[model samples]
Target: MNPVSETQSQHDSAKDAFFMNIEDAYLTALKQNPVVENGRTRPQYCYYDGPLTDIVLHNFIQVPADNFSEFFSHNHLPIPELIAISHEGVVHFNEMPADIIDEIHQQRTQYKVVDYIHADSFFADPLLALNVAKQRNRIYCGHPTIDGLQICYYRGELPEHGIENLLHLELDQAIEFFVDTAYRLPTKIELPDELEDELKTSIRSGFETIVNEVKQQRRTLISQLLAQAKQVTPKFHDGEPLKIMLPSSRLTTVMQYCSRAVAKAFEKRGYQVWFYMEDGEMETNNLIKFYRNYIEFNPHVIFYVNQLNNLALNDKVTHISWWQDSMPQITEHKALRWRGNDYVFSISPVLDRHLALTGAKNIVRQHFAVDDEIFNTDGDIERQNKVVFVGSSYLNSVDLSRPEQREIVEIFIDKIDNGEIVTEAMAGEIAVRFGLPPAFVFWNLLHYAIRDYSVKWLCESTAMPVEIYGRYWEQDPDVAAHFNGELKHGTQVADVYRSARYALVSHPFEINSQRLAEAAACGCIPLVYDCRDVAEKPHWDDACLFFKTRWELLEILKTQVRPALSPTVIAERFTYTAAVDNFIKHSNIGELSQAKQSRISMFVGR
Candidate 1:
């Protein structure tokens, strides 16, 4: 090849490499931060403000503007448009567009026209607006100084300060907060004459609209809930297998053990039980695949163990579900997507009422039952003197750590302390506090209060010989000394229960834990809080000792307080077999069983 052509080829190759490097860097920055389709300040790559000469560049390699000679002079290509680290610890591509424009401008006489890049970039819109907002002191709750969602502060000194203190809030929550404080804002601080009527009226109108929508939504949700209250006649066919659906993954050891116990109980009762286990695995991700598989199995009934999804079911098949965890009041009140389950069961009585009030007609309250064969301890095993607590941490559980929990706890305490627990004034106060149209704070208040009480009671209660075992308790210094590490879920847990003389229980909700029943079978007594859900029953008083206060618990622990019911009696009362029997009886499966109707063939035609 000619010498001129060879040199031209090298320059062209260098240009391609530079552009490719720029593209790669721009794409990388986009992936590092969250993408908001219509956001003002989120990091992104888009249009340039002006031609190559107009914008100032930072932390970039300076290349001579008028030279292709410089590119050929170096052996390797210079990727000037790649990411540059700024002095202020920010990751950005500085003057990235200018290099691209310079390269394009060199090839073309006039400015290169690009249609897609239109007026948004690090240099053009978001950064400039942010700086302007900072100067004007208008950026409120989302100031850069704040870290995470917890701590936030507005930077500006305000003329009407008390009226518009922006707390760290979600988009919807900010709107609600504005309306909540709007009336009070007008009363305290005088606003500009032009801003007064317009802003206040706008907020009041929005508040009115939201109130109307909430009422409408409640009606709609209740109607949808009432639709789910269909009664299906039970067609219990003997020898037909009962199909059980479990999650495809993250099945805990305790769940697996409990599920096996239920399955074994069915087998013992002369009905065939089929688990969806295939190739030593029993799980599926697709709803269609599960449905088709269920159809093929042709089971008498289907039981979903805490599964919550919509799937088509065979008309004749009986469907029932069991939910173990509690959701917030708003979440529970909203219509749930279920696969036409005829009956719904909840472990917590708190949940049961929540479901009922929200329109679930056939709601049954149930509890976790133990398989005595697996959980049983040797009668002569020496019981340790320490009082053991085997469960997960309640106060710091994922459900309780949400943004709403703190507000809920504060409001509940305030109302109770004011001696307005059952008053209309308290209800109105709660509604305003939570931004609920009406007071739906009962479940949330009870659940969180109980959990907080449990934590406080444990820390302040008697200095009894105690050992705590659960995940995430190691961080808490109070629990740190007593923490005996996380207890393994299955029979190993039962052994721990057996070793301890008494198991301390303080469940926030009414959900009967397997540990309580297992402890009894292990010849360990259970000392539980006298919460309505846990100790409401007469039988519970007989089987387990109940305490209302820290002093009450301390008094009991001063001696080796044995339960009134014997281990055998407790085991007999709380076994999976007994649980299953109760379920079958309560569900009215036997009475509603399909019976054969007498039929005679007509011979007159023959």
Candidate 2:
């Protein structure tokens, strides 16, 4: 109404917009900056970092892993297959297929790196629907592969140094060039007594000197990736997401969640976002409507988050196709892969190595957030010596055709029960012929079966005392067969847990398990297997004994685990509030508090 008021309103709106971008920018900058020595680069990919992650700095941490980020007491968790890609031209392929895994061991290969840059991109079907058409194809992993995570970089003209001609230096050589490079600062090549004597003046100066040297070195490496990013002839990338695509079937739910997190982070910031789940509906009429407005509206930015890029998502969108984890096709190690986003996000803290590789100067760490709402309800902490599982029914679907493998599982199961191991024939019949893998495949599997099996087995094994409870086990026949006819199914799990002492956790090979949290909530002190490939933590050690092989289970049975939990503590932790909060805080969404929530919010209008 009044001129003065209008002016102020406009200024404030502009200010908010500016500050928001600044926040995103500042956070992004953290990725390239070294945690300690500004010179040493680590990729800030995933939230979890330690001796293993510190080895080679990653950039922004992948969102899903960052969400449920936790360290086990023992390094006994199973590592999933991950895909990782870095600025350094697809660095390491760690999470190889099982056959490749065995071959690597058979050859005793300490480490081997593979690169599949041969793939290229080509667009087809301009208005191809997102979800529908793909489903009709009835297949997995068959989309045209696009290299470079879909994002393209192009600076106007060549800057004297041709990118292709520049010898691609090894990362170490690049880092070494910065660290140990011969710095002839117009004086003696060697820092003799003069510089050595300077240390006596102030410790700060000595540190500054090291810092300055590293900074200069970092510049050289950045120049390599950017100025030297593939020596193609100088041209402008009016680039768009190519029609090219790839099947993401193998890319687990964790991958989907990470992409969602990454997309949402940007959406909250004001960038218009579009994520085409293979199942998303993008049929022509809608596609045309989406396209017409995209062109008519002429949005400010277009962002893409996926395993590829370079396709035109309606030419007007400022397409930024980024992979949030390790390029799955590249890095085989899931941990390393999940942590590496093809591009960068604002919620996570980035490691320096990746910043140098991507030549990304403005990078930030966006972490997932804890809701504190899900774990809000009260739980009747069952203090019983029982185990419970609350996940998939995979255990009941084993295909027992593989008797040999079945034997291993039975042996594993027997060890799980402190030696009342199931015979191969028994396990084989239950797994293969019974339409499943093996009942005793792992800690995760153990979670599904053992609650009832342990209870039944204990009932039969030694009267050593046991009870089992879970969602699906009650519906199982094996448990029914063991039934001297005790209560089965439903809240019976909670009942058994309430009465039990040692709450068994089917943690087996996973770095993390939902059961661990559930058991903790139910006040069941878990008998957990120590998985090594993931994080190791304090309470984990205090709470559960970490074991691997069945033999280790014997040691656990003899010690570590106890019979009961203080009922009060169980109520405190397992309450819906605690459960939800822990899941949220530890989950990737927790990192969103630290990220630009604008990304996810942006898509809302779309």
| Best-matching candidate per TM-score | 1
Which ranges of candidate 2 are over 4 A from the true structure? 1-371, 376-386, 393-397, 407-477, 481-502, 531-539, 545-606
Give the Cα error of residue 125 in candidate 1, in Å. 43
Best candidate (score: lDDT): 1
Question: What C-alpha lDDT do the candidate models reach, one value each?
Answer: 0.48, 0.34
How far residue 271's Cα lies from its native spot in candidate 1, in Å, is 1.7
Query: Native-vs-model 2 lDDT?
Result: 0.34
The weakest ten consecutive residues by lDDT in model 2 span 126-135
Please give the TM-score that candidate 2 achieves against the real structure. 0.31
TM-score of each: 0.50, 0.31
- For all candidates, the clash counts are 0, 144
> In model 1, what lDDT does residue 496 have?
84
